[model samples]
Each structure stands twice: as C-alpha cells, then as structure tokens.
Target: MRIGIVNDMPMAVELLRRLVVSTREHQVAWIATNGREAVEACRRDLPDLILMDLAMPEMDGVEATRKIMAETPCSILLVTASIEANVAGVYEAMGHGALDAVDIPSVGIAGNASSQSARLLTNKIAMIGKLVRDAPSRASGRISVATDPSPQRLVAIGASAGGPAAVAKVLSAFPIDFGGAIVLVQHLDAQFIPGLADWLGQHTPLPIRAAQEKDRPQAGTVLVASSDDHLVFKSAQQLGYTSSPKDNVYRPSVDVFFESAAQWWPGSVIGVLLTGMGRDGARGLRQLRDKGHLTIAQDEATSAVYGMPKAAAAIGAAVDILPLSAIGLRIIEACGRPT
Candidate 1:
C-alpha cells in the first residue's frame, strides 16, 4: 500500500515515515508539511491512503479533508498528537470523509505504551488498506428478503467514514417527541463510541447512548453500536454483540445491524444509509427495502465519500435518494406517522 504523510512537525513526519517503511507491504508515497500541501499533493498524486494531522499552518485538517474528499476523493486517516484534545476537529474531518482517528505514535524514553501505539497505527493502516482494495459495487448480493410481519416502527441507520457529523445533522432535526426507536450502526473503533454518543447528544433533544447487551430500541432515544463486534438482533427485538463474522473489515458493521433490523425488528422499518466509504450498508439496506420498507440513501452531492450510498443507489436499494439535510425529515415523516 502506498501511504502519504501529512503533518507540520518534523518529528511526527519522521515517525510516520518510519512506521510506513517498517512494514514490508507498505511504502511511503509522499510527505506534506501541512494540510495545504496535503491537498495540493493529493491533487497532484493521490495515494492509497493518507495519514493526516488535525493541526497545521495555513489550513487545518478539517478544511483540507473537506476539500480533498470533494475533489480527489482519497482515503484518509486522522493521525493527530492528541485525539482526545481534538475531538471536535476529528469528527469534523471525519464528517468530511476521513476514515478514522488515532493518537500519533509516541517516543518515550523508557517503559510506556509507545510501542503499542505504533503497532495500533500500523494495524489501522492495514485495515484501511484492505478496505481500499474491496470492490465498491452493489453489496446487496448476499442479503435475503425478510417475510416476517410487524406492527411496531423502527428507524435503522448506517454510516461510516463521514458518519458522525452527518448523523448529528440528521438527529438534530428530530423533535423531542420524534417517537420512533432508532438504532445507529457507525463504523469506528469501540473506544470512540461513548464520545460519539456524547457529542451527538449535544446536537439533539433525544438521549443518545451506547447500546448494551439485551438492549431493545425504544422511542425518543438513540442507540449507537458500542462494541467492536457486530451489533445484531440476537433474538426478537433484543440487540446484542457478536464476533461471528471474524473476517469483516468494518467492525460493528452497518450491514450486520441493518440485516438484524430487517429480520428481527417487530415493526415497520425505515432504513437510512448515510455518508460513508465502501459498501458496508448497501446489502442490508436493500434487504429492508425488499421487505416493503422505506429506505433512504444520502445523495452524492451531500456525501463526504459517497461510496456506500452510491452502492445502495446503484442496486435500487433506496426508495428515495435524498440529500443529507432532507434525510432526517424524511425519516421523521415515515416514522412519525406509524407506517
């Protein structure tokens, strides 16, 4: 895999460079001193992936990510000095289609997690490299149509890459009495789930929290997949985590959740596929639609990556291909009226 490095600090750049070179399967494609240079470099020569920093002179990573995604459309991973400190910028960059965020590798004098951090970064890079190679085609090939009947109502949403910001935008439009139970499946590391829920809580009137074992989706509250394992409906209306699909690249896969929603949700469902990279949610969304449910996919113009929704749209999964701003309202109308 050819990887690009973008950071203002010389030490950080060197560290990243070494990390990339250390892997026999990966090599450094280019290096940029700042976000501005990154955008320009990306324009000139796009790599398989980019390790981007949030802070830089002239242009910050958030704006740079927004631009690069809109223009060149490359894979990006936020490699910052402190992910905890730059939580807002991390999500903003992700909303612009950056894949994931991690703390920069540390260089400690003695006993510390420096080596582990370095390993973590490499693992993230490898995971992203695999996703890059995956065919971004119609993912509805394996999903089977559901034949169960239901009287309740559910909104099952899936997003990746630029999900946090997009999800927040949609969730914010919901009124307190927006009475449908919501289950969100977002592609991200498990540790970040709490932060995502907290961040999203500030944007909407509904209570957003991490989904736990035996949890059932309820009205007026948002449940986010919390484990690294896949979020699925283990039994009727009971949400649980599973590690069965050991080879899935996107952990807590959107497809898994949506498939569960299609099979187990004891009600009318509205499947919403939002801004994301790859075709993670397309199949499951189509399954929902096949069961005579309303399904919405975010349009390319409003998407950060446009890969997942594009895949969904290509396979005739979405009943409506709407922009980001209009998705929430559509869901509310479909869900608010009790099918």
Candidate 2:
C-alpha cells in the first residue's frame, strides 16, 4: 500500500518513515510537514492511506482531513503523540472522514513497548489497506426480508469512529417508553466505555448502562457493550461476552452482536449500522436482513466515515439506506409505534 506521512516534527516524520519502510509491505508515498502541505499533497497525488498527526503548526490534522476528504478523498489514520490529550481533535477528524487513531510509537521506549506499538500501527495499516482494496468494487447484496416479519422488539446498533455522537442521536430519538430493548456495540477502548455510556445517557431518555455478564436485556433500556471481548447472546434475553473469535481485529464486534441476535432473538429485530470505519457490521447486518429483520445503514452524506454502511449497501445487506436523522423514526415505526 502507498502511505503518506504528515507531521510537523522532523524527528517524528523520520521515525514514521522508518516504521513504514520497515514493514516492507507498505511504501511511503510522500511526506508533509503540516496540515496545509498534507492537503496540497493529497490534491496533487492522493495516497492509499495517510498517517496524520493531530497537532501541527498552522493548519491542524482535523482541518487537513476535512479538506483532503472534501477534495481528494482517501483513508486517513490519526498518528498522534498523545491520544488522551487530543481525544476531541481525534473525534473531530474522524467525524470529517478520518478512519481511526493510534498513538505514535515511541522510539526510545525500552522492553516490548516499541514492538507493541509497531504491531498496533502495522495492524491498523493492514486493515485500512484491505478497506481501500475492497471499496471500489463492493456490491450491496440482495435485501431479503422475513416472510412473516415478526413484531419488532429488539434493536441492535453497531458503530465505530464517529459512533458516540451518532449513537446518541439515534437513542435520543426514542421515547422513555420505547417498547423494545436496544443493544449497542461500539468499537471503543475499554477504559472509555463508562464515559461513553454516561455521555450517551445524558442525551437519551432511556436508561443506558454497560452490559453485565448474564444480564438479560430489558425493554425500554439500552445495553452498551462494555468489555473488550465480543458481546453475544446466550438466549433471547441473556447477554454474554466471548473471546472465541480471537482472530477478529475488532473487539465487541458489531458483526458478532448482530449475528448472535439473528440466531437468538425470536421477534422482529431492527439492525442498524451507523457511521464508522471499516466493514465490521456489514456482514452481520446482511445476516439480519436475510432473516427477514429490518436492516438500516447510515447514508454516506450523514456518515462520518462511510466505510461500514457503504460496505453494507454495496452488498445488499441494508434494507433501507437512510440518513442518520431518519434512522430513529424508522426504528420506531418498525417497532409498531405511530409516526
């Protein structure tokens, strides 16, 4: 894959160059000292992917991402010195189309720190490469609805990247007495789950909490997957976590949860794939659609990173391709609620 590097610090740029060259599977296509240069470079010659620094002199990563995407779209991964410190900027960039974020690996660290960081960056790059390769020819498969279309009682949502805000928007649209259970699988670091839950709860009328082992999902409540393990269902009401799909890159995978729901949930189910990077929820959303459940994917205009829903739509997994604002109302109607 051809990768571009953007950072203000000379040393950081050199380190990233070394890291990319060391991989051998990828090549450094170009280098930019700041956001302005990065945007100009992208317009001239767009790389398959970009390693963008969050903080830079003059234009910042967020603005660069916005411009590059608006002009010459490409996959972007935020490579920053401090992820915690730049959390807001990271999300902002993602909201504007950046795929994901990772801490820049420190060269001076001892022990296995360097190796661990290298592994993380390589894995992310490899994932992005696959997304780029498959994006162009992706086909949305046939949308199959259940012949009987059971009464909707469960809603399963999956999102990553710009998910927190998107999830909140959908959840907030529900009334306090929403007569169904909501299972949300968001790709986020484990440490941030509590804070994300609190943030989403603040915007929604339904009570929101992280899923607990052996807990049954209750109507009128939202269960956010909390663990690093994939969240799945043991039965119609019971939720469980597993490390069985240890090879899968995404933890608390949206695919895992949606597939489990297709098997366990007896009633009509509503599956939603929101703004996110990669194709994690695409296959699972298809599974739900094949089972006759209503499946929705966020349209590109409203999606922060359109990868997941794009994949879903490409492969015919989504029964409806709607904007983010319309999803909640669609869910409510699917659940037999009046418009």
Candidate 3:
C-alpha cells in the first residue's frame, strides 16, 4: 500500500515514515505537516491510505477527515499519540469517515523499530487494506428461515465508515419504553465493540452492550456484534457467530446479520441502513423488504460516505429514504407505537 503520513511533529513524521517503510508491502507516498497540507496533498496525489494525527497547527485531524471524505474521499486511519485521551475526537473523526484509530507505537531501543504496537499497527493496516481492496461481493449460499412463532419485534441496523455518531444519534432518540428489540452490525474491530457500546450507552435511553454468544435480542435494549466473525441467528430465537464466509473483508458484516434476521425473526422488523463506505447492507435490506418489512436508508445529502445507503436506494430496497434526524422517529413510529 502507498501510505501517506500526516503529522506536525518532525519526530513523529520521521518515526511514522520508518514504521510505514518497515514492511515490504508498504511504501511512503508523501508526507504532510498539517491537516490542510494533507488534504491538499490528497487532492494532488492521493495515496492508498493515510496515517492521520489529531492535533496540528493549521487544522486538526477531525476536520481534515471531514474535509477529505467530503471532497476527495479515501481511506484514513487515525494514528494519534493517545487514543484514550482522544476518545471523543476519535469517534468524531470516525463519524466523518475515518476507518479506525490507534495510538502511536513507541520506538524500540537504539532505533530497533520493533514493538507490540508496531505489530498492532501492521495488523490494522493489513485489515484496512483488505477493506479497500475487497468490495462486498454477494455469495450464493442461502440461510433457511424458521416458521415458529416468536412474539418479539425486531429492529436491525447496519452501519460503517461514519457510523459511530450516526448510530448514537439514532439510538438516543428511542424512548426508554421502546418496544422493539434492537441489534446493530457496525463495521468495526472486535476490540472496539465494548467501547462503542459503552459510549453509546451514555447517549441513549436504551441499555447498550456487546451481544454475547447465544444471546437473544430483547426489547428496549441494544445488542452489538462483539466478534470479528459474522453475527447470525443459529435458530429463530438464538443468536450466534459464524465464519462460513471467510472471504468477506468487513468483519461482523451487516449483510450477514440482517439477512439472518430477515430469514429467522418471526415478528415485525424494521431495517435501517446508515452511513457507510460500502454496500454490505443493501442486499440484506432488500431481502428484508421483500419479506414485507419496513426498511429505511439514510439519504445521500445526510450521509457521510453515502455508499451503503445509496446502493440501497438504487435497488429500491428502502421503503423510506430519509435524513439521519428523521430515521429514529420513523422507527419509533413503527416499533414504539402499536397500530
């Protein structure tokens, strides 16, 4: 991968340069001292991926990520000094389409250039590479549906790219007595799932947590996919994980979970496809619609990346294509209110 480095600190830039060049699969494309420079450099010569730092002189990473994604869209990984300290900003940047975040790794003694953090960065880059190189292609396998009656209503959501904040905003609107069981399939690393749930729990009235193995989605609570493997329904009412489609680049794929819900969930369903970079949820959402479930897709004007929802709209999968603000109320209208 041709990687770009963006940081104001000279030492940080040098260290990132060394780190990026350490592996034979990667090469340094260009360097930017600030967010503004990074955006400009991207316009002139965009790289395969960028290592973006949060704090800088002219512009910060959050703004740069927003600008870059809005103007010249590309892959960005937030390589900041302290992810713990910048948790809010990290998600904010992600809301604007940054793929993921990681703290800068320490340099080894005498410039040895080897550490656990180094390995971590390498692994993150490798995963992001797969996401960029491998777009979602549909498989031919079919999952069987159950005919048994289950009284639980369901709300299944899929998101990526700029999903964190969007999901938070939508979930925040659901009242405490919200009637439908909620499940989220966001494109993220397994390590970040708990943090994402905790962060979301803070903003929403609903209880939020990572979905455990064999857990069933319950009303008035949110369950998130907790593993890198695809979250699925083993039975009509039993949740489980599977690695059957190993070729998918998006771990915890939305399509897998949504399709599982479409096939298995017996009650009323509302499928929502939020902002994302790819078309993972579009096909699954279509399946849900074909089953006569109410489906919603975020409109392109309000979407950060607009790829997933746009695909949904293109195929006439969404029953209502709405802005982010309008989606929650629609779900509440369908799920919270009894007809």
Candidate 4:
C-alpha cells in the first residue's frame, strides 16, 4: 500500500517512516512537513492512505483532512503525539472522513508501551488498506423486503469512523418513551467510551450508558458497547462482553454484536448500519435481514464515510438506505414509542 506521512516534527516523521518501511507491506508515498503541504500533496497525488498529525503549522490536520476529502478523497489515520489531549481534534478529523486515530509511537523506546503503539499503528494501516482495496463501487442495488411476525422491540446500531456524532443525532431524536432498547456498537478506543457516552447523553432525551455484563436491554435506554472486548447477546435478555474473537480487527466489533442479536433475539429486531470505514456490520446486517429483521443503512450523500453502508447495500442487506436525517424517523416508525 502507498502511504503518505504528514507531520511537522522531523523526528516524528522519521519514526513513522521507519515504522512503515519496516512493515515491508507498505511504502511511504510522500512526506509533508505541515498540513498545508499535505493538502497540496494530496491534490497532486493521492495515496492509498495518509498518516496525519493533528497539530501542525500553516494549517491543522483537521482542516487538511476536510480539504483533502473534498478535493481528493483518501483514507486518513490520525497519528498524534497524545490521543487524550487531541481527542476533540481526532473526532473532528473523523467527522471530516478520517478513518481512525492512534498515538504516534515514541522514538528510541523498547518497552511494552512502545511495542503496543507500533502494533496498533501497523494493524490500523493494514485494516484501512483492506477497506480501501475491497470497497465496493457505487451502484443502485435491490433491497430485500422482510418482516418478522414477532413484535419489534430491539434496535441494534453499528457505527465507526464518524459514528459518535451520528449516533448522537439518531439518539437525540428518540423520545423518553421509545418503545425499544437500543444496543450500539461503536469502534472507539476503550478509554474514550465513557466520555463518548457522557457526550451523547447530553444531547438525547433517552438515558445513555455503557453496557454492563449480564445487563438486559431496557426500553428508552441506549446501551453502548464500552470495552475492548466484543459485546454480544448471550440470550434475548442478557448482554455480555467477550474476548473470544481476538482476531477480529475492530474490537467491540459491530458485526459481532449484530450477529449475536440475530441469533438470540427472536423478537422483531431493527438493525442499522451507519457511517463507517469498514464492512464490519454489512454481513451481520444481512444475517438480520435474512431472519426477517428490518435493516437500514445510511445513504452515501449524508455519510462521512460510505464504506460500511455501501457494502451492506451491495449485498442487499439493507432494506432501506436513507440519509442521516431520515434514519432517526425511520427508527422511530419501526420501533414505535418506548413502552
């Protein structure tokens, strides 16, 4: 894969270069000293992926990402010195189409922290590379029509990349008496889950909290997957997190959770696949649709990144492909008011 590096610090750039070269699977396509230069470089020559620094001179990574996505779209991964410090900027970049974020691996370090950072960077790049290579071309596809005979009472939502804000928008539309429980799986770092839950709760009428082990879904409440382990439903009334699928790329995988709902939830389920960079929820949404569940995907026009929904639409997994604004209304119609 051809990867571009964008950072103002010389040492950080070199470290990233070394890491990319060491992998052998990827080569540095270009290097930019600042955000402005990165934007110009992308306009001239877009690479398969970009490792972008949040803070830079002339322009910031967030602005650069917005421009690049508008001018010459490409996969972008935020590589910053401190993720906690730049969490806001990280999410902003994601809202502008950046795929994910990770702390830049430190130079001349040999400890476990350094090793873990290195592994995370490499894994993220590889995963994004696959997403780019396997992305489906846009084409009008057929939607499968299916409906369960059982009463609908569960809403499973899956999102990534630009999910936090999108999830907030959807949840904010639900009334305090929403009829179904909402189970959400978002691809976020474990440390940020609580912050995200708090952030979303401020904008929504329904109660939002992290999913707990053995907890059952409750109407009018949004239970978010909060751990690095994948969240799954062991039965119709029980939720649990597990590390069994350690090999999966995205932890708290949307696919894992959606599949579990398909297996255990006999009641009518509504599966939603929102803006994201990978195909995690596509197949699982298909599984739900096959079982007569109503499935929806966010349309490309309103999605920050159209990869996941595109994949779902390609496979006829989504029964309806609507824009972001319309999704909330659709959910309400399907699930009805909280009982």
Report every candidate's CA lDDT.
Answer: 0.86, 0.82, 0.85, 0.83
**Alpha-carbon TM-score of each model against the true structure:** 0.92, 0.83, 0.88, 0.88
Q: What is the lDDT of residue 121 in candidate 4?
A: 88
197-280 per-residue lDDT for model 1 (tens digits)? 888998998899999999887877789999989999987778899997998888989898888888988778889999887899
Off by over 4 Å in 4: 109-113, 137-152, 337-339
lDDT of 2 by residue, 1-339 (tens): 889999998878887888888867899999999999999998889898899998999999999988887777788889999977776676667667676788898776432237778788888888777667655322111112222222247889999866777887888788776777888998876765676677787788779999999978777778999998999999876889999799777787999999999999877788999977678999999999999888999998887777789889989999999998899888877775421
Candidate number of the best lDDT:
1
- What is the clash tally of candidate 2? 9
Please tell me which model should have the higher lDDT, number 1 or number 2.
1
Q: By TM-score, how accurate is candidate 1?
A: 0.92
Candidate 2 or 1, higher TM-score: 1
lDDT of 4 by residue, 1-339 (tens): 999999998888888888889867899999998889998998888888999999998999999988887778788899999988886787778767787788898655442236767888888888777767766631111112233233357899999877877887788777766667789998887877777777788778778889999998887778999899999998878999899789887788888998999999867889999988768899999999999999999998888777889889989999999988888888877764432
The window of 10 residues in a row where model 2 has the poorest summed lDDT is 138-147
Clashing residue pair totals per candidate (backbone < 3 A): 1, 9, 0, 5
On residues 150-236, what C-alpha lDDT tens digit does candidate 3 reach at each position?
336788999998899899888877777677788999988788887788788888877898998999888777899989999999998
